[model samples]
Target: MDWNKAADNAQTLMQAHEALSRLMPRPDAPQQTWLAYYRRSAAVYTRVAEIDRGHFHETMFWATREREKAEAMEQSALA
Candidate 1:
């Protein structure tokens, strides 16, 4: 794996996560229901960053874990 590319991708993913986080709904916003959407987006980018760090199989495992967490959070929010 090219470390340079991996580093660049990680940076990009982190940046995207930051951007998505910034778009989260305000505390009193009526659209607060959408916060989970933003959180999941950020978590997805975080998983991509982990994969980009050259962890391959490990990253995949953690990504799946994170996805499960996001799904549970989303479901709880809906409930």
Candidate 2:
């Protein structure tokens, strides 16, 4: 497992999360933007979960404790 690759992926995921968060509705905005942002955020979160699962499985093959940590991170992200 390449730590660099994992770090890069984490950065990308965080950026997506930030972008989606900014799209949140404002009092003066239309309802459609709010709905769109919600859907987009959901999709981003799903992608993050998938990435996390993959990372967890890959790391688990080498270290059980690392796997557990990864799984916890994935669960926290979902929650």
Candidate 3:
């Protein structure tokens, strides 16, 4: 196996999660900000899915869930 690549993926995943947490919204952020956050989250998970490729569906599932959240947020913003 490609140990170096695996290590790199692990590190990247950690950094991505940390960055996501740092970007977490405060209580009063505007809808546009929330929408952007959700979209960024979806993109993150999508990259994770790509990085984890074929190990299982978990990453893709998370990606799908994130995208759903983004969609819901967008719908709410339009309402």
Candidate 4:
């Protein structure tokens, strides 16, 4: 196996995942759009945490982070 090729593939996958994770509905979307995105992301992480007990903490952390982002959006809207 070519270690360099394997590492390159892994890095590419991570970059792709990161890009997907940061995707929004649009470049100048409303607060509601951002809120929906974050809440949906939290739901996905929460479900994964329940299914993958071995990584519950990590998954829940992501879920919490997503929820926090959503809350921040809501708070910003209220302010």
lDDT of 4 by residue, 16-50 (tens): 23533555467677777778778866766676666
> On a 0 to 100 scale, what is the lDDT of residue 74 in model 3?
80
Q: Please tell me which model should have the higher TM-score, number 1 or number 4.
A: 4
lDDT of 3 at 63: 60
The runs of at least 3 residues in candidate 2 whose Cα sits more than 4 Å from the true structure, single-residue gaps closed, are: 1-13, 54-79
Comparing 1 and 4 on lDDT, the stronger one: 4
Candidate 2 lDDT, tens digit per residue, 1-79? 1113333244244544455445545756654444444444454444555565645443333233334444554566679
Q: Candidate 2's error at 30, in angstroms?
A: 0.5
Which lDDT values do the candidates have, in the order given? 0.51, 0.45, 0.64, 0.62
After superposition, the stretches of candidate 1 with alpha carbons farther than 4 Å from their true spots are 1-8, 11-54
Task: Give me the displacement of residue 63 in model 4, in angstroms.
Answer: 0.3
Model 2 TM-score, 2 decimals: 0.41
Which structure among the candidates has the greatest lDDT? 3
lDDT of 1 at 66: 48
For candidate 2, the C-alpha RMSD (Å) to the true structure equals 12.6
Question: What does candidate 3 score on TM?
Answer: 0.67
TM-score of 4: 0.66
Question: After aligning candidate 1 to the native by TM-score, how far in Å is the CA of 66 from where it should be?
Answer: 1.3
